[model samples]
Target: MDRAVLRDDMVDSLEHEAKGWINTESVSLAMRSVPRHEFVPDEQRAYADCSFEQFGTRVLAPSTAARLVEALDPTPDDSVLIVGVGVGYTAAVVAEIVGDQNVQAIDITRRLVWEARNNLARAGYNGVLVDRHDGSDGLPAYAPYDRILLEAAAIEPPQTLLRQLGASGHLVMPLGASTQRLVSVSKDGTTVDEFGRVAFSPMLVDGEQVDTVERNRTVREDREFAARESEGRHGWEQHWIDWTHGQKH
Candidate 1:
């Protein structure tokens, strides 16, 4: 099927089966207009409800994107800041609602940033800004976005992103480490609500390095400790020889 036909089919599925999942017309319209195929390589299966993974990034599933857009409730005049422009699919959809120039998306991966930028421009959303930078730090160059949506789940809403919200804006994201919730925080930085539980990739930080001497601990931490700090000390040189020889009194 052609892109238009495929796009329509995808939107229909979302509207009908998504049920109470999608509650806004703007998001519905975005689902209708944005051509998802152009952003991913699976042209034949672009309209599938499943996410397509590529280059360490995955285009979010249709249902997940729709729910996020619904929560954000963007308008034609709104400026939106989107964290994680994985493959530019979600950004393109948001651009359809809030004119292309009004959307700014960032991804920490340089390759994904370049790819998303090129994909969006090719799909006629050249006005959308896709940049490579730390997502948790927030893109300050375009501060005060009317709405912010994070595609990746974070332990908490980054204070930086919360601070960038306009006076009356909404910030939504899948938040948490073990259990995730689709959370919405108001601009004043106080009012918060949860849409539902969700599963998402952990938010990534660009150029982040942990101190080898001590890290909270992941599998990588133990490995790094062994490589950098293990087998070294107890202060007493004689103590080490006594312990190795099993001579404890």
Candidate 2:
């Protein structure tokens, strides 16, 4: 089957009543234009509505990507920053909406950075700049982006990323720890509109990349200390002592 036809079918399913992920025309057109197969390892399953794991990162399914892009609501010429550029599929889709050169992406893992670069090039979106950097820090050189999208989950929006957004810009990400919700936040970090629930991997710090050696001893020690503290707690200390739970002893 033709790749273009497959893309059409994929978008068709996304826009259908059962799964209305692709709402706007921009997102619909962009998803159709970008060749998803070029960014995925398994070309045969590229258009399937399923996620893939590559280089220790998750390649979001088409419906998930469509949801993110639709929430982003990017326009042509908008400067967009994409954190956690897994397989470059989402970046490619964004590149179609915004000009290719207007898209900047970063990943914590160096290998995934290389893979994303190569994948974008193969997909004819070489204009998208991809670099290996901590997603929390963002691509500062190109600060003040019109829109920012973080593909990973974060307990709270990174302050640095919020500072990098243009005065009127907004950021979309999966926010929280145990449970996550897809949200769009204003530049001032005040207004947050939740799209729905979503699940994504936690954002990686500087030394946490899968390819990097485990050399951050401080983090390891902190975890061990917390474990020891938990073990030491007993009886009332086992859980938070609620004065309201008991009247006087």
Candidate 3:
């Protein structure tokens, strides 16, 4: 099957699943225009609406991206910031609506950033900037974006990223540590409204990836220290008895 037809079918699925909740033409056209298969691994089936892993990162499902793009409501001249540039697919869709030069996307993973850059350029979205930076910090060098979207979930959108939003701008993100909600926040440096829910991967912090080995080692050490303290407490408690709760004053 032709890649274009496959992309069109994917967009149709996005429209269908949206169930009239999201049917924005710009969003649909952009979804149809960009080839998702190019960003995804060749071995896997790409035309499906389901999310998959690429470059050790998760791609948002087609419906999720559609809803996010619709909520963002980008314009051709708008400057957009994408917090998680997973394989550059979402960035590409946004770039198609807003010119590529106006789009800046970042990821905490260095390898993902590299893959995004290559995938975006190959897909003819070379104008979209893909970089290895903390999504929380955002692309401050290009501050005050007209629109901002985060592909990861956060308890609250990062202050720094929120600060980068232009006056009269809109930002969308998944709220809550767990049981995430898709939230849309519009601000002009004052007066904010955040509501909605959707689950997504947790945001990377300080632009650093989780070090599982180090984390596990720390957990073990803390447990051992806690056990030692607990054993000592029982021995010392007998000597330092509390009169209020005991027989002796």
Candidate 4:
């Protein structure tokens, strides 16, 4: 079967009433146009509505990507930023809608950044920029994007990312710590519309990428333990000398 036919089939499933993931025509067309097989390791499974793991990051399921892009609702030629580029599949879809030159993406993991770059290029979206940067900080050099999509979960919208949104922009993310919900926030950060529950890995900070030798939390936790021990009393200090108390009695 042709890859294009496979892609059409994938989009059809997403638009079908059973899934209803692709609600808008733009998303439907974009998904169909972009060749998902070029972005995933397994061309055989590329159109499957299932997720894949690559370079320690997740290649979101087609349905999940459709939901995100639909929520993002990017317009043609809109400047868009995609945090957590993953395998660059979502970025390619967005590029189809917004033009490759109008899309910029970033990832905290260096290897994944390279992976996304290669994948995007292979998928004929070389104009889209994929950089290795902390997702929280965003790509500030190209700040004030018309639309922002965060693929990772964050406890709250990153303030820096919010600051980078254009005056009339929308930032969509899986918001929450333990229980995540897909949400879209207005540029002012006041008008938030939730689109039900989702589960995504928490956003990674510096030194927390899968390739890092030591996680940031481990070093921070060790320092915290040391500080607590220093502030605490030792064995002899814990046992009060009762000389003064006994004399008073």
Per-residue C-alpha lDDT of model 3 across residues 156-187, encoded as one tens digit per residue: 55778878988878788877654777767766
Global local distance difference test of model 2 = 0.87
Residue 128 lDDT (model 2):
98
1-249, model 1: which lDDT tens digit per residue? 578888887778777853555667888788888878788777766788887667766667888888888888888979999998888988998999989999999987778888899889888899999888777878888989899998877665678898999888888988765688898988665637788889877676655322123323323334545755545654364343566567654
lDDT of each: 0.79, 0.87, 0.76, 0.86
Alpha-carbon shift of residue 153 in model 4 (angstroms)? 0.7
Clashes of each: 0, 0, 4, 0
Error of 1 at 138 (Å): 0.9
Regions more than 4 Å wrong, model 4: 211-249
lDDT of 1 at 166: 86
| Candidate 3 accuracy as lDDT | 0.76
When superposed on Cα atoms, how far off is each prediction in RMSD? 7.3, 4.8, 6.2, 5.7
Q: For model 2, which pairs clash? A: none
Candidate 2 TM-score over all chains jointly: 0.87
Error of 2 at 146 (Å): 0.8
What is the per-residue lDDT of model 2 for residues 1-249, given as tens digits with 9 covering 90 to 100? 898999999999999999999889999889899988888768677989998666777789999999899888899999999999988999999999999999999988888899999999999998999999987789999988999999988767788999999998999998876688999999888756788999987777787875444423223235556887998987567555556776334
Best by lDDT: 2
Model 3, position 54: C-alpha lDDT score = 54
Candidate 1 yields a Cα-based lDDT of: 0.79
Candidate 1 residue runs with Cα over 4 Å from true position: 17-20, 208-249
